[model samples]
Target: MDSDEDTFDNDNVDSGNVSSGDDDFAMEVDISSSRERQTEPEEYHYEVLTTDQIVQDMVDSISDVNGVVNLPRTITRILLNHFKWDKEKLMEKYFDGNEDKFFQDAHVVNPFNKPNTISVPKVTKSTTDEICEICFSRNPSGMMTGLECGHRFCKQCWGEYLTTKIMEEGVGQSISCAAHGCDILVDDVTVTKLVPDAKVRVKYQHLITNSFVECNRLLRWCPSADCTYAIKVSYVDARPVVCKCGHTFCFDCGENWHDPVQCRLLKKWLKKCDDDSETSNWIAANTKECPKCNVTIEKDGGCNHMVCKNQNCKHDFCWVCLGSWEPHGSSWYNCNRYDEDEARAARDAQEKLRSSLSRYLHYYNRYMNHMQSLKFENKLYASVKHKMEEMQQHNMSWIEVQFLKKAVDILCQCRQTLMCTYVFAYYLKKNNQSMIFEDNQKDLETATEKLSEYLERDITSENLADIKQKVQDKYRYCEKRRKVLLDHVHEGYEKDWWDYTE
Candidate 1:
């Protein structure tokens, strides 16, 4: 019969729907029915049989059902199957019946779980001619295999078989043992030990290790019948897969699989799943996309005139207000909707005389102060120069004359005071304060012209004494007038003719 037909036949027998005598007999002899048959004798049997006797009876029964050749094997298998006794303790108890050499040769200890060991029927060198059970090939050295019936095979052949199984059926899937009539599930750990170098091994190990972490929930292997690889879902909300084989991938990783790298599939999946509703809402509320490049951006403070970083299109927009280049007048400051005419009119209105009067006054006072400081510096320079000239005329040594001239030159180049005067004057003009000095412009021009001429003349050794006296007299007069002007500007002093006395 075909496998499907056989499976259907077995299902009929299992479900007790079949009416054959053999099927009825099989059901009657099954474990559940046997329990009913043994119930009446169970208490009496327990009373007569000691614990050891009961165990021996069980061993004998198993041996009778199988064969005498499998007596010890049946006993061991029965004990192991029934009670979860430590393998080591079971070995110790059972090996007592065998010779010391037999015990030593047959027993194997479990290293990881100590005190757990088992014994196999010793295969003497003479009996070691058995062929490798897996590939039915010659058993090579270093090969090891596990059997559901507790048999072992050559390590080399076992490795090859395991590799084939993993490369074929993969880990965590079903595969029968090499031994006929043995059906045990091969776990991933066994497969890993079998073919440590398989391509899937690394991925399997990663899945095993990371599976416990909640973040790795999306990591899964291809469930397709023939595929051996695993896939990771890049985004939990989106089911983006790399392969056209319908494998799911993480949203981020899935995007890489697209032709132009668009995450349309992932986006659709996310919308369907709605897995990131909270996160999406939060991001939408707090973040904005660049109007030009479509990149997500976060806004800090200030008016939301956002400039795009894309070189191709540097579109600026208000993030908070969602106003575009139109409102901002093509500039960040100009919101797309801002009325340029209205803004200009408002600015012009503010530029009227009264609005700027306070700024003009502030700069005017600053300019007067700066001029006073410049005058003081100039007076100091003139005094030093005069003193140097007088000392040079007294027939001072060359070193002394040089030192005086150096000091005078340094004072003359102390242009910080002059720079301050020029800056203040610029501010006065900028702020409309220069109008205050317009009336005296000609007098100031004449004073500057005279000062320039006086500064150009050199004081020689012969006329140094006379030049010194004349410069000192002029500096004193200039100092007194500058002090009066400064005090008048700062203190609102009466500007009478006596205040300007020479």
Candidate 2:
């Protein structure tokens, strides 16, 4: 997962070129950038975060809210939670309205008014000795917590309620008062004072600390299972952002970043791939070997009378009936029609559309197959590491074999991007204008497989230098063709030059 070695803080929006030989589709875009970030062909971006930094961002956001609202930071936090952390909308709607309703609803009744001293609630002596409102047990008024709703409950009852809300569920959960019908949100400070377990309070702190990132639209916690690091991007039409943890993902869809392809089209293609339509296409496009040389021959043009072009073993045969040309008695064309076995599975007009889809699957299946090849190619890193260690035994510095890993990673990324571009091309929607794209795709596929083959072969000390140069050369060639393909597709998408039908 080596991305361009850029820091997360460096989100400078910049422009780049995507040029095909004589064609160009120009558009403006913002991409992640940093100075001298990508040192080699196959690396990406990452940014790690510290707990202190995360907490500071939270504090800063709250402080900003407090400054604008002219309230204490704690009150601002409570108001933020009340509105699900949307400060601007909350202010626009309720800033000058009945402000006390928010404090009362949140149960964050201000102990101080204007400033100066704490305002204490008037405690009645009779109420202290009277029945405890919730548990029906007698308790001193000081031992009971009272919300602004005037509902008094024993500390034990409040503690159990808070535990149930925060511990039985997630710590950030908010619940109402214990008084039968009171819906006022019980404040966290009250929950902390009542709960006996110290660990539960720790969870509350953790929740509040990360709440800023969790609640913001522009920010998201990295999707990595063990990593809680969060990333932030401006809430605009942003491209994918790479995490410090080597997780690259799209800011818009929150899925893996698919550049040079539309998210909508990618979604449709994935769902299409999930169905068996493409799988069936692979079967119908099947090929049979030439009669003499055993070379697999696929029918491309019309007429069943086919001749093998393999110079050493040219053989004439019928494309449909699949036998020697002499078997047709020199004039019979019934072989052009479906034989009994073929007629059983024959579809008439519907088969025409099916054949079109099968044509798409011809490209798509290879795209996906190469994508799988890229994954296995990435695993080759481990194998390359072992080879490097083995080479070190011969007094060759580990640096000598390091080139192998770099070349492989570059090839994998290029091939993957290459594979996804076919999906883009298939859905480009401009059927009449894709001849050049197909040419680029065929060129890329050839160079890509050539590079893959070179890297995938066994590497020993004997052919290390020779194979390294071959991988370098093939990878450069593959990378060039890959870029040409994607550039053509990305330009088509950006400029909307191709009329996307689906």
Candidate 3:
């Protein structure tokens, strides 16, 4: 039996095409080479991978490179990391360049061009008198360890150094040798064998895996809070990707799939909001500076006569005309000297400032309203589930009452789309196409509100069928209108029909 608080959750399906059971917002890219235009909206394709899977993929990449280069796995891993896990780029540079120089640039010794030196096993018990470069101690009983560079250090010093680098410094992929001037890197095998503490070892492994994911352009860690999954895409683009955790975000910028508004504009919009720069806009629109002393003043009273509160310059002026009050004398209440060029220009500038502020607030208010509504999505889902149970108790089957849940789902999606539309509209320049886009936004907004209202209405056995039909009709209309708006925006993008102010 499904609980009254059941939410929509699904596992990641491994497929070439992006699919989220009933979610229409999942985007996919068309990889097929056809000059003919397709009718469907563009979508993105990606895979959600677990941490263990990410590690395994890293190992597989190392193995693949090792297969062709015939190098040790440890050396292959370092080379792959140096190239940011790009196998093709690593291969290109490895075969086409000077092998010794390439290895030196990567800070790894070429196993093939090694000078004639004694090959002592790492972490071996010391038999002859040798001073550890790190500790500067010649211990007869302590173990000695070193990399291929042959600068041996006491085993105790190696553990301490590796622990500091891994646990304290957070260095994972490119940790150089413990020797002072040696640039030879310590491989994962040597690190694992040297670091005795289980916690440090695990942290080192995690850091390595995270670095692999972060450095690779094809991968992105899911931005959902507390989610451990990472998404792997074949190519990078500002396309929507859905994680197995049911969180959908843009693979490029990691924001919620904000169609209509491109990633760069959305980034600028977010920065503007976070900076709270609109408060200064409001100040500029509402308040004026004193003409004489230039002291900033806000008119709190309704009187047109204004006095500069500055101690040095107590100049009297008219608030509306910003003209000297001495011209009016006792007729200050009806100052007709408003046509002066200076005052006219001042008023014009203030009007322009107010208009700009009004435009920003218009879009910002709508965007924030939808964002606020989406925060209650879980409550809406729970309310719909309860209604579903009530309908079930009134002789309706469990499947029959699913329309309520589906309507809520569509309502939430509509809200998200609506939120992004305002962002798109905020930057859009006024034109015939923009007018049509606004009309589309209006239609979608109307249908979404109707659907949301229908979902929140109390359901009873008396009007179950009637409400069911109405809810279904409204949600279908909402979904249809949403698609229309998005499709128009996509068309605008392709045909260069839309223009931005910034």
Model 2 over residues 403-436: C-alpha lDDT tens digits?
6666665666666667667777777665644777
Q: How are the candidates ranked when ordered by lDDT, highest leading?
A: 3, 2, 1
Error of 1 at 254 (Å): 71
**Candidate 3 pairs with clashing backbones:** 27-43, 27-44, 28-43, 28-44, 29-43
Order of quality (TM-score): 3, 2, 1
**Distance from true location, Cα of 347 in model 2, Å:** 6.4
Write down the lDDT that model 3 would get: 0.78
Encode model 1's per-residue lDDT on 1-502: one tens digit a residue.
0011110011111111122222322222222322322232222121122222323433343344334222234223323332232344444555566543332232322112233112243443645444555555544333445633355676665566666665565432334455565444333445545655645454333332222121233334333333333343323433233322332233344332221112443344334335555455446555667755778777777755688777776887666444464645434555333465654443344345333444434534554554564456445445545655666568865455443333222222222223223332332322232343332332333333334344445756677656545444443443343333333333322342122101
* Reference-based lDDT, residue 418, model 2: 71
Q: Give each model a TM-score.
A: 0.20, 0.67, 0.81
Clashes of 2: 9
Which predicted model would earn the best lDDT?
3
Top candidate by TM-score = 3
Off by over 4 Å in 3: 1-43, 114-137, 140-142, 148-152, 178-184, 286-339
Instruction: Tell me the whole-model lDDT of each prediction, alpha carbons only.
Output: 0.39, 0.61, 0.78
* Model 2, C-alpha of 318: deviation from truth (Å): 32
| Model 1: residue 12 alpha-carbon error in angstroms | 99
- Candidate 1 TM-score, C-alpha based: 0.20
Q: Give the CA lDDT, 0 to 100, for residue 373 in model 1.
A: 47
Encode model 3's per-residue lDDT on 333-360: one tens digit a residue.
4455566788889899999999999998
Identify the superior model by TM-score, candidate 1 or candidate 2. Answer: 2
